[model samples]
Each structure stands twice: as C-alpha cells, then as structure tokens.
Target: MTQPSQSNNNRMVIKLVAIVIGMFGFGFALVPLYDVFCDITGINGKTNPYAATYDVNTDVDTSREITVEFITRNQSGMVWDFEARTKRITVHPGELNTVEFYVKNPTAKDIVGQAIPSVSPGTAALYLNKTECFCFEQQPLQAGEEALMPMQFYVDPQLPEDIKVFTLSYTLYDVTGTSSVAMNRG
Candidate 1:
C-alpha cells in the first residue's frame, strides 16, 4: 500500500511539471503569434520593414487628396527631442512626398535609437507605402547633436474614397542595450 501511494505521488508531480513547461513555451510563442495576427488583419497598423518601389512610369491620381498627419513620440528612457517638421500635408495619391523629422540627443552620452512606424485608420496601412524612410535603419546621436531625418512616401491611388485622412506615427525607442551593433552601424 505504501509503495502504491508513492508511485501515485510521483506521477502527479511529473504531470504538474509538464503543465508548467507547456505554459512557459506558450508564453514565448505568443509574441510571434500576435505579430502574425497583426500582419494578416492589419489591426495594429504595423508597417512592413522593407520599402516598396513601384515603376517610375506609374501615373498619379490628381483628383483625390489625402491628408496625412505625422506624429512622433519617445519611448520611456529615451531622452531625445523628436518631432515632425510638418504636422500635416495634403497630397494626391501616387505622388511622392518627402517630410523631415528633427531629433536631438540631450544626454551627455551617445545613444542609439530605432524608430518604429505605424499608420492609423488601420485599414489604410496597406495602401500607404514608403519609398525611402529613416526608420529603415537605426540612428545614433552624440551628445548635443541634432539631425533632420527624411521620409519619402506615397499613398496608393486605389485607396478607398471613404477614407480621407490617415495618420503616420513613429515611436522612437532606445536600443542601446538590445542592439549594440546598431550603435556601431549608425
């Protein structure tokens, strides 16, 4: 009777350990799963890392106008002054436009940062394309240094007529500890 009771207890312990391990694995898997969900549905307006380039010969749609608003933010621990030079712009679809963002590092030490971009009116994210953007690469700024970053982009002519305005926002994150290589590359 004693041996049977010990065997049952051992089996219960093994089961609990397996359950804990499974839960731990599931937690790590959620990150990629969330990304996949956002990509497919465009729910979070996450932009693709790569810029898309269409043929130069493509025609612009001059009749429709799109109001693009730019917004900027600095993540916690990032001590930098950042803002869009132009708050908003009216542009025709398929017409390439450029805008500048100002960034200054006030801290005494050098810092490395990366800008992550997103579009609002999440459905419109698929139609907003970037040809050239500073967000594509990390930025490193020395103390007391300021820089003007440029972004070149266009809206697809096929964007639905119901959506007249869209916003593009960028959040700057300090990547010093996570990406030491980025600091060197910038």
Candidate 2:
C-alpha cells in the first residue's frame, strides 16, 4: 500500500510540472501568436515596414475623399520635441499626398531616434500605401538641431466605401544607447 501511494504522488508531481512548463511555453508564444492574428485580421494597425510601390497609371478616385488625421507622441524617457506639421488633410483615394513632421533635439547631446507608425481604424492599414516616410530610418540629431520629416502616401481606391476617415500616429523612441552600441561594434 505504501509503495502504491508513493508512486501515485510522484506521478501527480510530474503532471503538475508538465502543466507549468506548458503554461510557460504558451506565455512565450503569445506575442508572436498575437502578431500573426493581428496581421491576418488587421486588428492592431500593424503597417508594413517596406516602401510601397506606386503605379503612375493607377487611376485616382477623385470622387472618394478620405480625411487623414496625423498624431504624434514621444515614448516615455524620450525628450525630443516632435509633431506633425499638418494636423489633418483631405485626400482623394489613389491620389498621392504628402505631409511633413517636425522634430527637434532639445537635449545637450546628440541622440538617435526611431519612429514607429500605426494607422487607426486598423483595417485601413492595408490600404494606406507609403512610398516615402522618415519612419523608415533612424533619425540622428545634434543638440538644438531641427529637421523636417516628410511622408508620402496614398490610399488605395479599393478601400471599403463605408470608411472615410483614418488616423495615422507615430510614436518616437530614444534609441541612442542601442544605436551607439551597434556603431561601436561596427
């Protein structure tokens, strides 16, 4: 009887350990899984990181106007002043448009910053084609330096008829430390 009891306890312990390990594995997988899900459903406004090719022959749908609103933010610990020069613009579908953003380094030292962009009404991200954007590269600025960043994009004419407005937001982060480390390594 004692032998059987000990055997049962050992099995229970092993089962619990397996469950914990499985839970940890699931936790590690959640991020990539969520990204995949978002990519498929267009849930979190994940925009493509590559430049979009524009066809000059594409017809501009002048009748369909979309209101695009620009917003900006600095990540916590980032001290740079950043803003979109244009707050909002009305654009015709399939017609190219441009907007400029302003950034200044107020700190006394040079810093490298990177911008991450997202489009709200998330589904519209798929149709928002960017041909040129500052967000594509890390921006390095000297102290007291100011620069104008431009973004050129167009909305696909095939966008759903019910969607007439979308918001494009950029969050800038201070990546000076990592960038410096990489540069040193090189």
Candidate 3:
C-alpha cells in the first residue's frame, strides 16, 4: 500500500513538470512559429510562390508575348485586381524594353497593396517599364481606380555565355507589401 501511494504521487509530479515545460517551449516557439505560418499563408508577407517559365531566343530579333500573372492566397474579405500594360512585346537580344504592370483597387474604399516581380535569368527589370506597379511604391488605389506600374528589362545575348533559357516569375501578396528585389542586367 505504501509503494502504490508513492508511485501515484510521483506520476502526478512528473505530469505537472511536463505541462510546465511544454508551455515554456510553446512560448519560446511563438515568433518563429508565427513566421512560418505567415509564410505558408501569405499573411504577414507576400512572396512569388509561382512564376511562369518561358524561354526566348536571344539569337534573333523577335516579338514575345508573355503573360505576367498575379496570385493571392488565403486572403479574407478583400478584392484585388491586376493587369499589364501590354500583353505582347517585341525586342531584340541586347535591347531593353519597358513593360507595365497595372494594379487596381476594386473595393468601395481605398486599398493599398504591393507587387513583387522575379524576372528570369538573362533578363533585366526596371521600374519605368511598369506603367502601374505598386511594388517599390505603396499602391493606394481609390475605389475602381486603376494604376499602371512599369518595369524596363531585356534579354542579353551576353547571358553567362552558356545559358540559353530564361524565365520571369512574379508574386503579389500582402494587404501591405514591404519589399522589392530586382534584377538589373541580362
């Protein structure tokens, strides 16, 4: 009878200690854990989760019709819209051209958003190229008003001398965007 009572008392102490340690671990993991959750859900930050891959022949002077795409994930109660200045463009290898990315606030009130673009290798990007990008600048859109953001870029015949294929990917995220990373040379 004495042995059984001591065993039960020890088990209760062990359980209490386990709960306390578990809570401390949980508290310590809060910040990192929240970051992971935001990354997966696109809540705290926006990322280019997907990009369309395309290959251009830098050897020839031709026109390329590349569709830039925008995607939002796990958003709640906000409507966002995006458009491009031109759907098709013509350029020669080593010649840089400017393109546009248009974002709109479709809601009844002013909406702010950000755009992040990732251009493929052997290509460059510029802000002037976008007629309406809310990326480098915070885009504050009035209800039903559209803005054009621009990016200037081109494919270089000088791409690594060994690379032949390139792709550009853009991902727009966050109700409030905070980053802009660019590739300036082909």
Top of the candidates by TM-score: 2
Residue pairs with clashing backbones, model 1: none
Model 1, position 9: C-alpha lDDT score:
96
Q: How accurate is candidate 1 locally (lDDT)?
A: 0.90
- Candidate 2 lDDT for residue 180: 47
- TM-scores for all candidates: the values are 0.87, 0.93, 0.44
Residues 63-149, candidate 2: write the lDDT tens digits. Answer: 888999999999999999999999999999999899999999998988899999999999999999999999888888887888999
- In terms of lDDT, the best-performing candidate is 2
Cα deviation of 159 in candidate 1 (Å)?
A: 2.1
Per-residue lDDT over 1-186 for candidate 3, one digit per residue giving the tens place of the 0 to 100 score: 699999999999999999999999999999899977765643442323332222443344344323333332223544667656565554455455667676777677656655565543313322113323345554556667876777655444443434333334455554544324331212
State in Å the error of residue 128, model 1: 1.5
Candidate 2 structure, TM-score to reference: 0.93
The per-model lDDT (C-alpha) reads 0.90, 0.92, 0.51
What TM-score, to 2 decimals, does candidate 1 have? 0.87
Off by over 4 Å in 3: 1-78, 88-90, 120-134, 161-165, 176-186
Q: Which TM-score value belongs to model 3?
A: 0.44
